[model samples]
Target: MTMLRRNLMHAKRYPSMTFSVVVMPVILLLIFNFVLGGAMQAGVGGDDSKYINYLTPGMLLLLPAYMTAAIAVLVSTDVTKGIVNRFRTMAISQSAILTGHVMGTLIQAVLALGAMLGVAALCGFRPEATPIEWVAAIGLMLLIVFALGWLSVAFGLAAPNPESASNMPFPIIMMPFLGSGLVPTDTMPVGLRQFAEYQPFTPFTETVRGLLMGSEIGASGIISLAWCAVIALVGYLWAKSLFRKQSR
Candidate 1:
């Protein structure tokens, strides 16, 4: 709890940084809903407003990706400043440090996602989900964030400096673009469509969209869960290993 409070306080101290996490996704939501919605709508066979329904889930998935840099930068800054070292000298639980970071990232993700959902509601986006489905969707999103948040911490620890750490997670931002986030995978060329269908982000995005829109999740739900589990395990181990090496 102490570590978590400390991390949250650090985030509060830099409002602008966290504010960008909320703003960027909202801006992109507006642009895609207004400017690019028509062209994108063609693939989904719906009007712009209806398209917003499809797009909102994708944007929600993209939110954490965009915020990955901030998490990486924050962790790397702490490492660079020798804060991790100082903490090691204390009697505090070492795992609390990483857990605090993960919790902080999840909170930021929820805020950013909520902001985007609010804008989406204003823009005529509505899902057919029941209360249970809505809860499941939120859980799924947090699971994804939890997995990726750990990876971002690992990236931050791996980078030579904070600036490079911030850029190291760039591929996550592009994961949506390469998946079915923007358009139907069937609309893509065979190769790209194959890639889109098989990628980790697509299954998760599709699962969220399915849950929210009352569509079939089928195998995508299982795949998404599996992906999240694998990522969270790997990232936790990787981040812990890095921290241990730093301590030594």
Candidate 2:
């Protein structure tokens, strides 16, 4: 609780970091929902409002990827500023600082997701899922945020500095473009289609889309869960090991 409060205070002091996370996705949501929405609707065999249903789920999933860079910057800043060293000398739990960072990132990611959802609602997104499905969707998103947030921690800890840490997660921002987020994987070339079909973000987007749109989520849900679990485990272990070395 102490570390979480401290991290939240740091975010309050450095509002740009959190603001940047909200800005990029909100911009993309607007551009995609208004400018490209009609064309995309035509491409997907749906009306403007109907396309919003398909588009918004993918956008919701995409938000976390971009937010990873923000987490990377925060983590790298703490390490570079010798905050980690300062914490090591304290009597708090060794993992508290990292846990605090994970919690902070999750909270901010949820806020960013909420902003996207609000804009999406204004843009004509109305999901058809039942109450249970909505609960499941929210749980899935939280799990994804938790998983990816840890990966960002690892990225931050691995980077030599904040700038590099911020850049390390850049590929995550592009995963949506290359996957099933913006378009169907079947429309791509054979090789790209295969890659898109198998990528982590594709399953996530597809699963979320399925849940919201009343489509089948069986396979995609399983794949998404698997991907999240693997990424979270790997990232948590890597970050823990790096932080331990830094403390020593």
Candidate 3:
């Protein structure tokens, strides 16, 4: 808990980091819903004004990915500043440092998600979800944030400096754009369509969309959970090994 508090305090001191995390998604939501919404909606055979309904879930999925850069920078900053080494000299749990980062990022990610949802609501994004469905939807989003938070930790630990750490997760941020986020996968060419359909973000977007908009979830929810598990396991193990190596 101390470590978590410390991380949150750091975030509080560096408000720009948190602001960036919150602003990017909100900006994208506005741009996609306002600027290119008509053309994209027409491509998807939907009304331009109603694009917010389709875009909101994907934008929600994006909140975590945008967060990865900030989380990575924070972890990288700690390591490069010798803070992790200082912590090692103490009698605290070794994993606490990394866990603190993950928890801190999760909290910020949730808050950012809420902010994006608010902006989405103002942009005419309405959901048909019941209370139970809303709960499930939120649970799924939290799972995604938690899983990605660990991945960002690993990225931060692996990078030699904060700058590289910030760039390491760029591909993750692009996943939503390549998936069913902005447009339907069917409109793409065969190769791109297949990739978009099978990517991790597609299932994440689809599952959330289904939950909120009353569409068929089919296997997307299960697939999304499986992807989260795989990502979290890989990230946890990788970050643990790296931190241990650094300890030596």
Candidate 4:
């Protein structure tokens, strides 16, 4: 509970940064939805909306990829400013203090997703099933975010400063082009295509596309769960080790 409160307080203190997260996705959604909306198509279902449909799932998955990894920068910022050392001198729960920032990232992920969904609706994507399916889809997205969040935490702690964390996402931003976000992997070079097709982001994006379009894109939905489990396990373990080392 204290973790949640501290995270929420941080969020309130940094409303502009929080707003940028939401706004960046929206801006990307519109740009993609308008320019490439008609050229993209996936699955057999009738839901063929572009930009929002194509971009939303990608945003849903990759947002955390960038957001979490970038947290290294925030952590770096706090530490470089001596805030973390100051806090360490006080009596703060080791786990709560470390995880509290992650909670803030998670909260940002949820809010940004909500804002993206609103954009999706405005652009003509609709649910064909019950709200439970929407919830389930969101749950899947959240799982990915959580897994990626830990990676961010680890990176933030391990990074020399926040600027390093800030720069970590540049390589990640290009992932969508290689995955299902921009074009079908079938259309790319054989080797790169295979990598993109098999990568974790591919499956996760496929799952989101499946949920939004009311049909399966590929075996991606199944693969997505597997990726989430593996990443969650590995990321959390690494983050835990880092947290322990930092506190020591």
Candidate 5:
């Protein structure tokens, strides 16, 4: 609890980070919902509903987006101030500090995600899920985002600067749009379609959308969980190593 509080303070120290994390998603949502409505219907791209549905699931994955921004700020500022190195000599539990920061980012990510939902509501968008479906959706969001938070921490702590940390999620973030997050895999060429079907975000987006739609789990949820688990495990190890080395 104490560590969580401290991590919250870390975010509070940089309000701009919080604002930024939510802004891009908002813009993307707006662009898709309004500006691109005609193009989406022309089949020049794909179904906007399918795209939004996929994005909705990916938005659950977006907790990582917020975490990446916040972590960049936190790690960069601490390193710049030399507090990280000083703290290495303190009694603080090594993993606790890093994990605590991750937890806080998870919380902020949840809030930002809720804000995204609010935007969805304002835009007259609605998912036809039931109560249990809603509960499952929220739970899924928490788990995926929490896992992705570790990835954010790893990148933020390991990167050369906050700017780099912020850019780290860019590739992953763009994956959703370019792959299955906003369009059907079958909509693309055979090669790209195959790649999209197999990519990490494809499963993640599909599973969450399926769950929200009360459809069968199939393999999407399983695959998404596996990807999250692996990323979290690797990210934890790397972040811990960097924290020990840099903070030392």
Candidate 6:
């Protein structure tokens, strides 16, 4: 708890990190929904005004990716500043350091997601989910944030500096664009379509879309959970290994 408070307080002291995490997605939401929404809707056979409904789910996925960069940078900053070494001298559990970063990122991700959803609502995004579906959607999103938070921690611990850490997760932020987030995969060329359909973000976006819009979830919910589990496991193991090496 002490470590967690320290992480959160550090974020509070540096508001720009939190601001970027929240604002980037919202800015993209506005640009996509207003500037390119008509062309995108035409391509996808959707109403221009209704593009927000389609875009918002994918935007939700971006929140975790954005938060990942912030967490990574923050983690790398701690390492570079010798804060982690200082903590190592203390009597606290070693795992608390990473856990604090993961939990802090998760909390910030959730709040940023909520703010984006509110912005989506203002932009004419109306979900057809029932109360139960809302709960399920929230749960799924939390799982995504949790999984990605650990991944960010690993990225942070692996990078030698904050600048590299920030750059490492750029591919993650771009995954949504390559997937079915902006438009249907069917609209893409053969090779691109195949990649878009098979990527993790596609199912993640699809599952959320299904839950919010009352569409068929089919196997996407299960696939999404499986992906989250794999990512979280890999991230946990990698982070543990890296931290141990650093401790020596």
Instruction: Kindly report which residue stretches of model 1 are placed more than 4 angstroms away from their true locations once superposed.
Output: none
Candidate 3 residue-wise lDDT, 27-128, digit = tens: 989999899998899766767778999999999988888888998999999999998999999999999999998898878877887898899999999999
lDDT of 2 by residue, 1-248 (tens): 99889889988998997887788877887898789988877657766778888788888877788878988888899999998888899888988888898898788877887888889899888889999888888889989989998999999999999999989998888888888777788878999999889889999988888888897777999999999999999999999999888777
Candidates sorted on lDDT, descending? 3, 6, 1, 2, 4, 5
lDDT winner, 1 or 2: 1
Residue pairs clashing, model 1: none
User: 1 or 5: which has the higher TM-score?
Assistant: 1
TM-score of 5: 0.87
The sequence of per-residue lDDT tens digits that candidate 5 reaches over residues 107-190 is: 887788788888876765567788887787677667767777777777778778777777777776666775655556777889
Best candidate, lDDT: 3
C-alpha lDDT (0 to 100) for residue 53 of candidate 4: 52
C-alpha lDDT of residue 199 in model 6: 85
Off by over 4 Å in 6: none
Candidate 1, residue 121: how far the Cα is off, in Å = 0.2
Positional deviation of residue 53's Cα in model 1 after best superposition, in angstroms: 1.0
The residue pairs in collision within model 5 are none
Q: What does each candidate score in C-alpha RMSD?
A: 1.0, 1.2, 0.8, 2.8, 2.7, 0.9
Q: List, residue by residue over 1-248, the lDDT tens digit for candidate 1.
A: 88888888988998887888778878888888899999889998956669888888888888878778888998999999998889999998999988898898888787777888888999998899999999999999999999998999999999989999989999888898888788889999999999899889999989999999987788999999999999889989999999999889
Per-residue lDDT value at 189 in model 2: 95
lDDT of 1: 0.88
- Scored against the true structure, residue 205 in model 5 reaches a CA lDDT of 70
What are the runs in model 3 whose C-alpha is more than 4 Å off?
none
As for TM-score, the candidate ahead, 1 or 6, is: 6
Looking at model 5, residue 209 earns an lDDT score of 76
Which ten residues in a row are the worst by lDDT in model 2? Answer: 40-49
User: Between 1 and 3, whose lDDT is larger?
Assistant: 3
Candidate-wise lDDT, in order: 0.88, 0.87, 0.91, 0.71, 0.71, 0.90
